[model samples]
Target: MYAGAMKDKRSDSRLVLEKVSHSYGAVPVLNDLNLVVDPGEVVVLVGPSGCGKTTILNLLSGYIEPVSGTVRREGIIRTVYQQDGLFPWLTVSENIAIGLRSVEDPARREKELLDLIALIRLEGFEHHYPHQLSGGMRQRVELARVLAGDSDILLMDEPFSALDYQGRLRMRWELVRLLEKRPHTVVFVTHDIEEAAQLADRVLVLSNRPATISRELHIEALRPRDLTDPAVIGAMKEILKELGLQV
Candidate 1:
């Protein structure tokens, strides 16, 4: 991963995978997969189960490296998993403060912590422990913690999959709102086509393992996309069709 802009900065690719391929022991997972995510764009990855969607995320986040090809990333990265990584012993405020531990100024740190609390709309629950909050609320704190950092890229792996149908829908809206306030280049993986339609600037459909891009759909609609809108529905249908799930 390259740091700040200087001489010999390769390109503007915020995150990139070039001719990337990986395998698990004897099993091939990804094959010559090439992707480039520009700054501030939300790219959603969708594929059948066990198609190495999360593996791609792990590659981008440097949790693992491709056995072949190159992975290049610029700027700091933070990941939000399906489950909230909140510390049960830490209060909401304290948990968020963990992200700001790098700040040397106490006053600034406290201010930023409170700002993140407000950003996640958990102002009143600042002192509450994780168990005291609902699952959705705990997830919000997880998001807030990530946002509190200076990371410019977010790798989210099925971040809302644990939520109920209604809860998932609500979190999508909340994510759009938060991103509008503090935009980050996001790579989200999900099995939900509707979620991809609602959140992605571009949706990538992957084929079954030895995963490769089957189709790439660009959603032209703006964020907070209307679910019933023709463009949104059309995109969803196109994705389903590409995945051979049109029924």
Candidate 2:
């Protein structure tokens, strides 16, 4: 199964950052950073608190421009952040249907929204408002809404950081299943090593201020990886080491 999944991966570049550098009013963030995300690949960025991980996402999303190098994005990009950006007045189904507002066929659009609602496992709560759902449920709605847009690349900035321990774990699996059904080139940013190890196809560790690529680790484990598995533990340890931790 692992080999099959790997074999089906896309070989083309979906996003690339070459010698990218950025600064905020003289405060340097990324410095000569280079990275590439292939089509259908999930790449996670983890680093110190001020190490420009979020800055990388902003650059890819075109929210900010790089000062030095180039950011090449090959397809449509969508983002899912730590906060659940849902409309309080809209019901779950209504919020997800927002992505299909451009579709001219009502039947096709309704089918897509219903499929997404089921994919996120929120079928029965379609009529519920954002304020009525739990943190994890809200994040699921956010993800469903993004997937409904059929984006080529998904830029996620700590989307699950606010969840409790078990909630985060469950959501990780939830994400894997969703992507399996509808593949998207994903760039995820997080400070949690375990999260990176669990969700990434490749994990890139960044340096401190004026952050550059410190180390790149490929996660060869299959889906639904056990958090306590020796491979996962080892991967987390290596990430910690790159961050200057004694472990």
Q: Which of the numbered candidates is closest to the native, going by highest lDDT?
A: 1
Off by over 4 Å in 2: 1-13
**C-alpha displacement of 122 in model 1, angstroms?**
0.8
Candidate 1 local lDDT, 1-247, one digit each (tens) = 2234421222333998999999999999999999999887899999999999999999999999899999999977888989868889999999999888778899999889889998998988998999999989988998888777566788999999999999999999999998877777889999999999999999999999999999999988888988898888999999999999897
lDDT of 1 at 225: 86
lDDT of 2 by residue, 1-247 (tens): 2234433433343899999999999899989988888888899999998789999999999999999999998777889989858889999999999977767799999999999998998989999999999999999999998888546688999999999999999999999988888777899999989999988889999989999888999988887788997778889999988888855
Which 10 consecutive residues of model 1 have the lowest summed lDDT? 1-10
CA lDDT of each prediction against the hidden true structure: 0.89, 0.88
Query: TM-scores across all candidates?
Result: 0.94, 0.93
CA RMSD (A), model 2:
2.5
